[model samples]
Target: MSKITNLLAGLGGAIALNVIHESLKKKSKETPRVDLLGEEALQKTVEYFGGEIEDEKTLYKATLAGDILSNAMYYSMIGNGAPQHLWLRAISYGVAAGVGAITLPEPLGLDPEPVAKTKTSQALTVGYYVAGALVTAGILRAVARKKE
Candidate 1:
């Protein structure tokens, strides 16, 4: 029962994190564009990058790439890919397991010491999360470039 509960909690945490991340990204996309730098400033950037402001397509692609990168960074920091998030989830699971171990009688009379070793589980979860994030970021970047 405790193992099942922990699994459900972990799944819930991951889903919640993903939802929050997607919501933030959507909100960011809806933000009004602020041209802090005037046309002259933009022209300077174009010149520096050895590109001319030719068409709206190119500008749109650049804007999309910037947004994707920003989103990737933000998600990587606050989402499941980070060690802090993993540790937090692990602690949650640990507490749940602890409660079960104490409240429910164990037929096998198993000790909770093994269950308390959450570091390995946390590390594995974090590693997978980071790997998935990197892969998704790469895909987004490639798609953005292709769209350009």
Candidate 2:
């Protein structure tokens, strides 16, 4: 029971942290744009490879491709808007929760055995959350650089 409680606490903490990080990212205003020229270049390359885009459809296709790639790049960099980030954040919180469950102590009025176990769990859980945060931030930074 103590383990479960500890795990829950750790997970909760991680989730809160992720939310804060996302808010910070949004506050910074990382904007995303569609690169029409890039799409045109890609279309030309495809044509060179014997895949021709008819003139009437070329503009439409280029715009569609540009929008897709631009959105992908934007989402990857601005993870606050990406579903993958939410999933990752959840996983990170779960890990922290599991650790907390094992290491964190229960409340002062609670049993000592549970408390000790919770403490151990929490220690590991916090570590996992920290690692997750670093990894997420690094990924976002890499995506931003790619856009540049």
Candidate 3:
């Protein structure tokens, strides 16, 4: 795939993931608060560098931007190989990221409860990632077909 196409597909997936997460968070307390985790990490990183945001809103915006960029880059890996494996790559990347979100926080000194509080929370977290991946794969396939 062309680099532009790959980046666009990845960006779409990341946006989709955040859209589902933000929507669910508004209606359900059980929804994962990945934002909180991101905020915490950002705060620590800032402090580590002797910098402080000191404003909640600014911190949140920064974290959200960072999340989109990082997630897009990570999801872009799905375009690394043959188009035939696009779905597989999407599922694999989504599941891995979902599982990692739930499992990695504690070890990394961040709170895990935001995503792993209960079975429902965990399941929903994974579902959001899968939804994002499916969106990405669908977009990629559509573009590929257009090219063919």
Candidate 4:
């Protein structure tokens, strides 16, 4: 892929991830729901660095920005040269992000505990990330087929 195509691929992945993630969060009431990876990441990151957010609005915006940036980076990472197995890629992405999602917050004092409260919740939590990756891969594949 050309550089522009590569960049568009990343953006496509980001859009797919965000849309799926948000939708799953809204639709699923399963125990270990992931409501705010970006928000938690931002909060924990700031706290880890010993910074304070001035207010809720600022924090909210920062969280959204963080989420967008993360999706771009992650999808770009996968699209740049990762394997072609979308399911495998999704599992890997889910595991890596899932671990960080659960572990990073409390150590940084951002939350009382990991967001997932039970086993099913935990699985579903990771599943959402996998679903996002699937969405990304599906979008990329569809576009490629359309081009052909």
User: TM-score for every candidate vs. truth?
Assistant: 0.27, 0.26, 0.96, 0.69
For residue 136, give model 1's deviation from the true position in Å.
Answer: 12
CA lDDT of each candidate?
A: 0.38, 0.41, 0.89, 0.61
Error of 4 at 111 (Å): 3.2
Clashes of each: 0, 18, 0, 1
The total of clashing pairs for model 1 equals 0
Candidate 2 per-residue lDDT over residues 1-148, each given as its tens digit:
1233323333333344444433442232221111222344456666779996667566656655454443233223324445446446545544553344333323312232321334443343344345444444454444445666
lDDT, residue 51, model 3? 100
After superposition, the stretches of candidate 2 with alpha carbons farther than 4 Å from their true spots are 1-78, 81-118
TM-score of 2: 0.26
What's the ranking of the predictions by TM-score, best on top? 3, 4, 1, 2
Which window of 10 residues has the lowest lDDT sum in candidate 3? Answer: 22-31
Could you tell which candidate, 2 or 4, scores higher by lDDT? 4
C-alpha root-mean-square deviation, candidate 1: 21.2
Q: Whole-model lDDT for model 1 versus the true structure?
A: 0.38
lDDT of 1 at 32: 17
**Per-residue accuracy of model 1 over 1-148 as CA lDDT, tens digit each:** 1233333333443433334333443243332121211222344567789977766666655644443443344333322344335445444433443244333323434332322235443333333334334443333334435666
lDDT of 3 by residue, 18-52 (tens): 99888788577787888888899899899999999
Better of 1 and 4 by TM-score: 4
